[model samples]
Target: MHLPPPSEHTMVRTERVARRVFSRLNLALLLTGALAGCGGPMEPAPSALEPEGAQDVQAQALTYPSGSSQTVVSRRVVFRNGSGAYQAAAGFEHFRAAGAFDIALHNIRIAEVDAPATREALVLMSAGQKISSSGHSSGVTGQASNWDASCDSVSCPNVSLDGRSLAMKLRALGLFPSGKTYLSVVNDANFDHLFDSDTKQRIVNGFSNWLQAQVRPETRAIYLAGSSRGGCLMMRMAQALRANTALDGIDIYVSSFDGVCRNSQGELGTFDSKINNPVRPWGTFYGAWATNLTAQFPRRDRLHIFHVVGGQEVAPATGIRAFSGYAGSTPPSTGTNLDWGWYKQTWVKWQHKEIGNPYTDPSASDQAQAVAETVDAHLTWLDARLP
Candidate 1:
């Protein structure tokens, strides 16, 4: 049966806050950031990259040099169905060569209309920004419809965008660009309808399944990040990794203000739950998704997860607690906490009590600073443990 829609109270409040934040952030970005030129409308689909006889493909080999500290390789991989070939565009900061190091970013797929263009664009934009700031070059890979497995699911009519398969594709790409990779995955849904049922399901399936393989030795140190639904996928992936022995080496760090998940009691748990009564659908969906993945490797101690949520944000507190319950207690506490006040306090201390109103402050600006600190703390912990 189809799930009920999210509550109006939560939706309305989220929209209101989002609009105000967007307006302010846009102004700030416009003033300080250089906007990328939007490419003309998507051109005709490029030819297929898949070989005629290949199916259930194997991962390609990508070896990093043994003593290579100066060079960091970055790659982007995309899996699409009926869309077109994946092409890598040059000239972005992420792809430019830097001193004593060749930092390359690759795109997994070319532009395809089947998925939400705006979401894809935003991901590309974010990747570009990250590359610019970090001085890394990136590339993209392409795959065709035959590669998608979820579209072949009984619930869906034909090969739809499968998060599981897409994850596999990314894993393959990571083999080559192995040093430190930033992977982004998005479902095939319109940006305006990101919260809809189908879109949510796609994200759940995509991320949960992908997390299964990403935590291996070949790719464990990669950083996980996303926004909105993408953020939700990242959280679920962290939870899944925590429960899987095969993923023990992976260190996950996520910041999602608008994602949802299920508590151990099968209750709806998300930031939106407080405002929206009967979060059953979201809970059930996420629970089912997590259960399926956890069952694949049921041991509790295999995965160690660390995440931060805005205390003011509805889901992080409840969701993290529920996830902690599912994961059971571990040494040093698998979950770390963060909220608006905590961030504000940290900001004020760092700035010598000069900043004001963390709650009403711009989310983008505040979150950027908050996430950096979170990542730094996580890295310190990881270095001591992994090194």
Candidate 2:
């Protein structure tokens, strides 16, 4: 049976580039900061509607190599070390609690999505401005769901969009190793600053810290899934892990669903003319990053990167639609916007949100079926990469 429709706030295209003004901080600046240390005073931002017992946290400043600093803020939880490394921090002891699920010190939500019969694990980063809700019926008796009781409507939970449904489906079909597999959901935390450079940086840092702490070299496999903006963040985190010589030779897989990237000023574009243009900072950052990855990774079996797109989610040639980047236009026939040319592509006959979270828009039964099929296809593509 279908679940209730999500709140209107959930339906809004949170992926749309927010036009709000903020200080300039580009990708280069962020990378510089990651290499440097945190400094400067932080500006206070509103707290997320976090789960109960969540604390009102303060934002942390990260100093970059450029001598400029950006304030990285998280309403629900503030990382002890804003530098984004895997370090022991206060209030982090709960992650080792004697149970299948526990909130890590960085405020990451970890749960056993699958039966711990195997050591493989999946890490998920949901699209921007979304939260975990109750799972819809799977129509299969004794089927497990992706629901987490700790998720509250008031707070932005760490669970990704449609994360529960995906885990349940993968488990039922044996696509995911059911034995001892953990699902770590990383939170974006600040939808209010959805397109801000610091907001996105927080996600990248959180995932990277969690990965460094959780995934051991002996771990058999690691699967990463990201939707919308998260897709880019996942790749960024993977790139960092690859550079870390200590975690050498471990298998890593990435699945990107309609991934899009924005610039420091919260602008987006898919066309090369727009992206590569010096004035259009939005598309330029995305274009350069995608191009770099394509050249370095070359889509090898070990690198396992897959990209899926909603057939209808084409952006305008101008690419800078204030509210919906994918609206008001069609993709250029010249192939300019296909940033990740190396990725094996899968196309789904749905819109952006539908493909990202099929359980959304509960207006038609066929939509549900189509979502199920799309998710099945994505999982199958990922499963084939499993050793």
Candidate 3:
């Protein structure tokens, strides 16, 4: 079941010194833009198969701090398993309209994965993509399947998903929300560009706006997930939602994977020479905002956050040196590329970080299920904490 990498792109190993120097320059330029309060126009490089107008309908420029700005957006598209074509995740009526699930990916902090997640929408929503389709039959029950509505070779109204191992698990759990919204900015050069305070605000605003217009009153159990910097953003948004009067009456659960998140615990900075500064975002200079943001909530008990990490370290083949800030090689929405690096003494250590409590890193595979399991465990944890 080997799916070849994109013919145009390959994840080859990059030289350490060159990559670091570039990353430093990138990070510096980012900080400079942050301080200057003025940014030049951004160039939109296409990553998905569709044009911007097709991918995002309500396209508009979102202003950012430092005068920097780009078009931040929310989009929905569907991928049917075993089919190579993509369908609209839209026109499905309302938020809880069945047949699809709604999830939020946040990168509200100084840096986040919103860009990569959105850019890779084609790959993310590609029905043919391996991550979503690989060996999903193992999770099926009875002759009927969540992907029974095959769209390939036939005109069926329903969208065929990646069966139970992936999207099906979500649908069965009722976490898959309809009217899917993708949140991210264009010209996302990763790292520094990601630290746009203005764009973050706009994205958060978009979330609120959608809730006002689309979300059905009966919608319950919204699953909000983010990774790395996105994790910080998720927590920030979680705090807001908990206190938000508009979002009241709906249960919100958060799941963060290898995300630099915490109220005031855990260590920061890189582990070894192999690892350049880890994006332990929850406590970075900018991360303090997340802490303050989370604390402002009146009821912390209502918002439950789950932390999960499978293979909480850089891939052995890539090592820390093969790092890319959600670079082109990265797959969308999936948190694999931006996962945390091992905190060992050196690459010589070459050992995987100990799988954390409530999380078992099945190396690269099963991350989706791992996350679902983590959320289930968090619910249990929440129940225990409540009474």
Best candidate according to lDDT: 2
The runs of at least 3 residues in candidate 3 whose Cα sits more than 4 Å from the true structure, single-residue gaps closed, are: 1-161, 164-167, 174-193, 260-296, 309-387
* Tens digits of per-residue lDDT for model 1, 1-387: 998888844554455456445645665675344433444554444335432111111111111111211111222222222454433233122211211111111222112211221111111111111111222111111122232232321112222222212123333322213223434433221111123444444433433553343333345343443332334445555555555555565443333322224333332232212221111222322211121223422443423333222212223333321121122222121122222211110110111010111112236555333323322232222222321
What would the per-residue lDDT of candidate 2 be over residues 1-387, giving only the tens digit for each residue?
999987633432221112111112453566467656557545454344321111100011111111111111112232334554433333233222311111333334333233243355544444433333443222110111343333432223333223234444444444443454555443432222234555445455555665566664346556676655555556666665666666556666776665655433432222232222111212222122113344344334446666554423224342321111211144222222222322554433345455556554435774544444345445555644554
- Encode model 3's per-residue lDDT on 126-205: one tens digit a residue: 11101123211111110112232332221222322223222233323222222232222111101111324544444444
Q: In terms of TM-score, how similar is model 1 to the real structure?
A: 0.32
| TM-score leader | 2
- Name the candidate, 2 or 3, with the larger lDDT value: 2
Error (Å) of candidate 3 at residue 196 is 1.2
Cα lDDT for residue 23, model 2? 14
